[model samples]
Target: MTKDLYARHRSVLPDWLALYYEDPLEITHGEGRHVWDSAGNKYLDFFGGILTTMTAHALPEVTKAVSEQAGRIIHSSTLYLNRPMVELAERIAHVSGIPDARVFFTTSGTEANDTALLLATAHRRSNTILAMRNSYHGRSFSSVGITGNRGWSPTSLSPLQTLYVHGGVRTRGPYAHLDDRDFIDACVADLLDLLGHTRPPAALIAEPVQGVGGFTSPPDGLYAAFREVLHERGILWIADEVQTGWGRTGDHFWGWQAHGRSGPPDIVTFAKGIGNGMSVGGVIARAEIMNCLDANSISTFGGTQVTMAAGLANLNHLLEHDLQGNARRVGGLLIERLRAVAAQVPHVREVRGRGLMIGVELTRPGTDEAAPEVASAVLEEARAGGLLVGKGGGHSTSVLRIAPPMSLTVAEAEEGAAILERALRSI
Candidate 1:
């Protein structure tokens, strides 16, 4: 049945849409951190649907909210004063840390980033943008313009002139060998040099942890240094926290907090994890920047009652249960466990990331070259051993992405890590 479904999927879907594993899976149902395939096989889900399922599968709170909202009224758009929408907006604004923050909701992260771009471009009256090398924003035309990752970006044509900057990747760039202070200084100098050559830009968009680019991040104070330079020139700093937000990084409530040395970012774009599995993405910005556009705008499917309810429930659950602390504890153990095993594996070049959002990059045994084939083998092997992990990289390298729900138990983490260890060994 899965084979037949795969055949139909290929016939109808675009060729570029990728599926994982040698044989694709049809997931029938999931609960907690585990899922079942069409063949009734069980698997411990480590990827959490590409980091979207922030809480857990079949979370009762979120499920009850969705069901109750659906039973009441779910179709009310932004035209009406939706209670759930406003409440969720208030909650997000309080947590967003942007001064006088205002929230705008969308259906996906791409649209959220698109809105951020529009705001920055309009507020600054310039189309030139600065983005970190190997950064991934989203798939929309405007978002792809700012994305520096070649693998995720499909087109060069863009509405904005996006200049790729340095310091997103910490281990493989020209300044990789430098210590933390020197690395930050080098990247700041590079950014200054870039600014001197180009016209005034609207914004510098970056991911605190490069999600699709192998979970690479700069030194702690790198963005803070960049912030000072950008602030002097009136350029907005957009923190794309799509994959790193909602306590996934463990130590901080938001990934931008790690770089909060200067101040909170001018604008923050978020998606994926906020609603757990529900489609909820939004942008938060100060009043001046958010109100730049005079024309009335609304997202048709954005901020619907159902999605907002789901978001509210998910956020409440996350905060009430202190899942961030859980991620910090469990993720710490998991990463250390992974590092211990990775030390023995010749193919592992690096094990990096914060909290639950972690990456294990595989290279050739004795060479620095990326071993994508080996990564693929590991993925299949992991699936065979009843574990599900994801893969990502900016430049065709294979980085095993391990981001389970924030509520992952210590026992589950141990089990998943053991399964992953076996997979890496097999490869």
Candidate 2:
């Protein structure tokens, strides 16, 4: 059935679409932190739809709003304003700590990012966009041009001006001992120098904790310092919180907030968790930048009625249930457990990330060459054990990307970690 479905869609879908990563499992439905395949096989979704669906799947409130809105109206296009869209925009701006920040919605994370790039380029009226090496923005031409990873940059990459720099925080000594203030300072210094010298960039796009690019968490002072430099140079600081937004980091409402920013980004883009599996994304910018988008800006399917309802409900549930608090508590427990497991397993290179957005990088038996094959083996083994994980990073390193729903339970976290430990032992 899966093969037939793929075959039927192959003709219309672009040949470049990488559908092979998905196995033959026909996912029927999902709830909370688990999903079931067509054959009634249950799999714990540690991947959380690649870090989206933070609150969980088929959430009661979100589903109710989606279904109700679907009956009333599914879409009216950007030409007309809908209540759900309006309310969602208001709520997003409110939580973002940027009052009256205008929003431009899109149908997906890639679309949101693509729109952000266009807005930044046009607003700044400059050519250069600075991005971190090994970062995964989106596949759209403008975004792919700025994405530093070569893996995603094929012939389709846009011929636009851009600069790339090393991203992610580096750690030394022992996994048992974190809080390496000195190392953090050095990383900050190097980054500041790079950005300072490469001034005049239209915008510096970054992820709070480098997602796909190994889930690297930069030094504590990196983002704020970088923002200061950008402000001094009049460069826009674009925070691509597509993967890290919506309280997944636990301590804050958005990953940028986790960076200790008093105010949010000059422009902030989000997608995944806003709709909790439905297609929706948005860019929230300061009024200063928004005023610049007076005309000649639009998105065809931005924040459709149904999607906006879903996003609004998801955000509401997140706030009411204090999912951010859960994320912090559960995420801390999960991180500690992962570090414990890594200590036992020599193959585990580093366990890095914040909140529930975690990645476990694996090295060779004794080398720096990212053992992607080993990572693949671990992933396959975990799947066979009924746990679904995700992959990321430059060489697609052995980073078991475990971004389960923020509703993930302590018991689920332990079970998932155990399964992962078993998979690592086998690998």
Candidate 3:
């Protein structure tokens, strides 16, 4: 049955849409932290649908919210007063840390980012944008233009002039060997030099933790240092919190908080996990920037009742359960366990991340060269052992990304670690 479905998927779907595994398993249903494939095999889900399932699989609160909202009214355009939308927006604004903030809802992160770009360019009156070297924002035309990763970016033609900046990845760049303070100084100096060459950009946009760039991040306060320079030039700072928001990073409610010394970013964009799988993406900014557009705007499907209800319920559940604390406690133990296991593995290069967002980089045993083949073998072995994980990196996709739901238990973490250890040994 799985084979037949796979054949049909290949026939109908775009070839560029990649599928995992040599024989793609059809996941039919899920509960708690586990999912079952069509063949009746159950696997502990670590990737959490790319970290979209922020709480858990089939969470009752989210399920009930969606069901009740659908029964009442699923969608009414932004043309009307959406009570649930307004409520969610109010909550987001309160927690966003942006004063006098306003929220704009969209159906996906790509749209949210697109909206942010529109505001920044319109406010600054410049089409130039500064983005990090190893960043992956989204797949839209505007977002791809600012993306610096060649593997993910498919086109060069863009309305905006994008300048790639340094310091997103601290391990493999020109300034990799520098200590934390020196690295920050070097990156800021590079930014100053780059600013000298180009016209004033509207904003410098970056992911606090580069997600598709294999969970890489710069030293703490690196962005704060950059913020000083951009502030002097009146350039806005945009934090792409798609994967790092909603307390996923443990210590910070938002990834930008890691560099909070400089102050909050001028604009913040988020999606993934806020709705626990419902498509809820949005941007929060001071009223000045958010209301900068001259013409009226409305998202037809954005802020619909159904998605807003789900988002509100999910957010309530996350806060009520103190999932952030859970992530910190459980994720810390998981990383330590994985590090111990990796110590015995020849090709595991680094285990890095905060909270539940962890990455295990695979490299040649003694060299810095990426070992994508080894990563693939490990993934296959992991799947065979009933543990599901993800693969990503700028260097030939050689990093294993493990981001379970915030509700992950210590026992589940240990179980996943054991299976992963066996998979690494097999590789």
Candidate 4:
């Protein structure tokens, strides 16, 4: 049955939409941190549908909220005032850390980013954008143009002239060997030099942690350093928190807070996990920038009553239950155990990341060469052990990404780590 479905999927879906493992999975249902397949085999869910499921699966609060809202109405268009949408916006705006903030909802992270780009360009009156190297924003045409990773981007042609900046990844770069302070200095120097040769940029978009680039990140305060430079020139700083927002990183409620020495970013965009798989995303900025458009703008299906209802329940549950505290506690233990396992394996190049968003990079046994095949084999073995993980990286997809729901428990973390240890051992 799985084989038949895989064949049909290949025929019907776009080839670029990738799937994991030698034999793909068909998850029938989920509860807590585990899911089941058609064969009744249960497995640990570490990826959380690409970290979209912020809370546990089949969570009563979110499910109940979704069902109740569905019974009433789904879409009423943006023409009418939406109570749930207004409430959620109020909650997000208060917590966004932006002064006089405004909120605009979207259906996905891509659209949210598209909205950000639109606002930045219109406000600054420039088609030039500054983007970080090895970043993955989204799949929209405008988002793709700003992305610096060739592996994820499909075409070279773009609507905006993007200047790629350094310091997104702390390892594998020319300045990797430098200390944190020196690295920041070197990157800032490079940025100033780049600015000398380019047109004025509308904004600089970056992920607090490079999600698709193997969960790598620069040292703390790197962005703060950049913010100082950009602020001097009146350039805006936009933090793409699609994967790193809402306490997924553990130490902070928002990823931008890590670099808060200089204050918050100019604009913030988020999507994944906000609705716990309900397709809710949004952009937050000061009223001046958000309202800089000459004409009115609205999203028809962006903040439907149903999605907003789910979002409200999910956000309240996440905060009230203290999931971010759980992530900090459990994710710390998981990363330590995985590091111990990786130490015994020579091919496991590096174990990096904080909280639940960890990455284990694989390489040839004695060389620095990336071993994508070894990464693939480890993924299959891990699945065979009843554990599900994810893969991503800038060097040919050689990093294993481990991001469970923020509500992961200590016992579940230990269990998942044990299964992952066995999988890494086999490789």
- Which lDDT values do the candidates have, in the order given? 0.93, 0.79, 0.94, 0.92
Pick out the ten consecutive residues of candidate 3 with the lowest summed lDDT.
18-27
Best model per lDDT: 3
- Give the alpha carbon lDDT tens digit for every residue of 17-97 in model 4: 998877889999999999899889999999999989888888899999999999999899788999999999999998899
Candidate 4 runs further than 4 Å off: none
lDDT of 4: 0.92
Q: lDDT per residue, candidate 2, 1-427, as tens digits? A: 7778777778688887664144645679998899998778899999877777778888999889988998988888888767888898888888787666888889888888877777787788887888876678887777888877677777444756787754354542222134546554554566567766754678888888778777877666567766776787788888899988888888777777855553568889999887888899888888777767566655678878998988899888888998888988999999999899889887888887778989898887666667888888898888888899887776655577889999999999999988998999897
Model 1, 138-234: lDDT tens digits are 9999999888989898999998999999999888889999999999999999999999999999999999999999888988989999999999999
Off by over 4 Å in 3: none
Model 2: runs farther than 4 Å from truth?
A: 3-15, 20-23, 156-159, 171-199
lDDT-sorted candidate list, best first: 3, 1, 4, 2
Residues 148-169 of candidate 3 have per-residue lDDT tens digits of 8888889998889999999999
lDDT winner, 1 or 3: 3
